[model samples]
Target: MQQDRMEARTAGWGQRQGWGRRADGLARAGRRPRRVAMGAMLLVAGIAWTAQTLGANTTPVCKLSVCWASEADKLRYECDSGCYFESNPVDVEPEAVCNVMAEATHEGSFSYMYRDSVNLVTTGIGNLLASVDDAVALPFMIEENGVSRRATEQEIRDAYNGLSSQSAECIAGNPRRCNTANSYAGENALRLEEDTINQLCQTRLANEFTPGLHRIYPDFDSYPSKVQAALYDMVYNLGEGGLSPPKWPSFNRAMGRKDWQGAADESNRPQLGTTRNDYVRDLLESAADEEEAGRQRLASCASPGFP
Candidate 1:
């Protein structure tokens, strides 16, 4: 949210701040003031970079004065000392990035237990409870007489078992709309708050999905945001192994070559809905368009000009 807020503020400033006259005045001024201004600018840039590097919302356990060349280097030193970084540096904030995947996986829903298409007992944004331990690990709340309290382990186990026992027909027929209708829509239905669901999704993205994606695509951070999101969605839907070579050979080849259109052509997943498939395709195509536009801009900049 801090990143989102910062982007909005930057956009507003861009509209009002005309840099032409200020730049000209600064140029006219002595070189000393310009040097000082440049120093100030660099300092501000460093702060912004640091904020982005360590998730804006996350507080680092320890601070290091030494500069590191990459996030991996920073993590190696920091994590060795039991320090925790919220996430790796990404084009988009971790929370916003998770939201993109959540939209496709859970469709803006964040409460109540249900069954996924494959009949897995799931809750809050497609979070799967493979066993009773998984259910008890999460702090699920239950409501009674208009009051909310944390659900006991037995209550959680009961709810999970209730959903797990549902027939495949039930799962297919009713996916259980979030916050509205569910298999157990009675007095003490187990639920998770929106913030809790977001944290769960974000944690998985940061700890599991993102690290796995990085291992597969080593230069993942360098890719365009849309491409990154597309790859992220793939990894989330189909585990890291599912997107690697031998499993998705054609897609892997296209990605290796940085061929956005080729990758888009190979991105279809028969099991997923057309809308989700289209979203991934569109992201890849959009990246291709951006790459083409960048090339055109470079060419124009290099051309001989009378001015």
Candidate 2:
């Protein structure tokens, strides 16, 4: 039946129908609505059978150093002595580390210009423009310059140069924006402010979104890191309120069931035209593959009472 649907897709008939050679339409035809509906039905049926046989919500036992708990309705694991339950994926991994690709992605879409059309100077990978009131609120903003004025372009450059090398390079076209020892010391005040602001955002995001995600998906930890990261990005960008059913019904529906592909489709809607959904889907699959390989290696090692 699936094969019949595959064969019935209209893309292959494009040439015969003189629809030109740009068959980009066929590129993602596998995601046809009917096919997705059928696949979802099969998955639900399988899960239902498994639940009936194994009992409802019976999570598998945990291994060493992994403990599960529910908070604000989210199921999470406290691992390696860290309370890494529900938090924005961006916060899970530092902006400097996690979602590097996503940030770079925005650079391409938004361009690497110093300032936007509105004359807001940019700095970081997401271009962290000065136009955002939050940027002004960044602790790096100096009040007692004795002049009691907004930071000048030079001051902004000096402040950012001290804290983030990667972002500074992207912004200033110089990897060593603050190379000299004296140069570094000169920006000490600004650097302190930058660190404070960074910490503030992290704290705020964790407090705001962590419990909300817990409420949205109780078994959040069981989800692939990529999926968690994507969800974090969504909430971070749109806020918990914006991520609700009225704003993103399909994403909410697919995500509620851990249907990553379906969720990806919902995220990759044509109107949005963003690669975030596909990126997360790929990351999740890649992470799963790596884990499977690690398990296979461990199994091989454990043969004959451990090598």
Candidate 3:
């Protein structure tokens, strides 16, 4: 009886041990597949993230391939190209994108005209262009700063059109306001924008001055050409109302009538008895200092960045 009991107990222990080993093997096999699956999922996620990043940066230049009904034969399209300025429905459409690109050519080919609104002052072609170049030229880019910027070709044209409209509204087309003496007054003087420059130059500056500033500056008594440029900078800073012109009534009447001292006196007055006398004093003194320096350090600072 004792031998039989011992044999049964031994068999039972062996059976228990075999069952435990089988369970351990099964658990390891299940864990290995789950680890492989988790690794595969992680790899897929990484690849997807990398792909998305690349897609975001790249702008597909569709060379007339994604051509919509409204697109031109040679139009170039990029990401969201037809959405803004060129769509047919005035929404995102095919023609709209083509129009956007077409606008670039027009703006590039178009002339830059700059004018002052305060005195109805308009700049000469040379001066206008140089100023515009000073504002906009930077390798292949032009920064608008507080002003709006058009990144693509379409954007440039859109900005040009919008500003052109503003120019029309600002100018009442007052002939006296457009005069070189008075026309070169507020707009361009105050607003150193492409549109303001264009209005002052194209509308009045081009037509208003006899030969532009050359015509007017020579008439100024005792005022040198360098001084005239300085005065314009002054005008740009201060309005026509702010202008004193060294006894201007006497100066204008004398253009050759007043003589040098008359114009100089009006220009150099310590007080004008109008507006903020203190402010006027500072402006006049600053402009004079810049002129006396006989270099472009101050004048360059006067205008804003890019038209």
Candidate 4:
């Protein structure tokens, strides 16, 4: 039946009765309605399956150390939910250093990026890769002795706080960010601020979050992927400390149980300065540009990954 459908699709694409070349109309004729119906069916079926198989369809992807990216662990950086972390298909021996990630049910997760190996060297077990370059694939080769597996909840908390803590230095006592090393430099502060706003929207607000991004910002329904890409780029550009989401200190104020007045007050601190004021103002405007750029980017074939 699938073969018949394929053949029909192939023949349906040939030129029509009168036209010299195959027009979209002719190509779409027999296959159009079926394809449309098929697509609808698949959507419904997929959604139903997802709902039944995975409740809520929210909070996608498990948060593990590997799910995070960091300077320390090569495989840990941007590690998806499996034993393998590399992108390009490569070979590895059976179990070694990295254990194939399994669910609580003890079932293995499947990934297009992962494949079974045969007769490959088992020195490192190479089951889970971290990163891959042109010559070698996965970061399993980068392992050392002191590394630990599966981050503890304390580690997760510590990691999150530790990473987030660095934001203050740039935004700390130095309003100008002039003394700060990573502060966006020179006349580009406007661009820097705009970028920072986007960053705020992502990491602090969104984080290069795993699996589902659309859930957090339902407001971005019209431009799901675009807003996500913009948000990540912004977070990357702006430190997680200041300049995004609630815009940092204000964000911390709220986190610290400060009321709306305090939050708004902290948020408004930039208004007190010309340079900082100009930066925020430009960022709001830049968001529109970033959104449009995001739309164009989302429209393209590119799937925006983390910054």
Give the top-scoring candidate (TM-score): 1
User: Could you estimate the TM-score for every candidate?
Assistant: 0.65, 0.41, 0.23, 0.20
Question: Per-residue alpha-carbon lDDT of model 1 for 86-151, expressed as tens digits?
Answer: 222223456766687667442445577765665666667667778879989988998799999999
The sequence of per-residue lDDT tens digits that candidate 2 reaches over residues 118-197 is 22344333334444354444434445745434465566555544343334543454434423222234433433243443
lDDT tens digits by residue: candidate 4, 166-191 = 23433444443322212212211111
Candidate 1 Cα errors over 4 Å, as ranges: 1-91, 104-108, 164-188
lDDT for 184 (candidate 3): 28
Model 2, runs deviating above 4 Å: 1-91, 94-102, 106-137, 142-197, 269-274, 284-307
Clash count list over all predictions = 0, 1, 37, 12
- Using lDDT as the yardstick, the better of models 1 and 3 is 1
List candidate 3 stretches off by more than 4 Å. 1-151, 162-211, 217-230, 234-250, 258-261, 264-307
The digit string of per-residue lDDT tens for model 3 on 1-307 reads 5543433223222222343344456667873222111111122222210101112212111111111333221121111231111111111111222222123211111232334333121232223333333334311123466553434544333333323222543365543333232222322212234444344333432243312334444432122222333344334334344444443565454334423233444544332223323333333344334333322322233346411
Ranking the candidates on lDDT from highest down gives 1, 2, 3, 4
Worst 10 residues of 1 by lDDT: 32-41
Candidate 3, position 119, lDDT:
19
Candidate with best lDDT = 1
Cα deviation in Å at residue 85, candidate 2?
A: 17
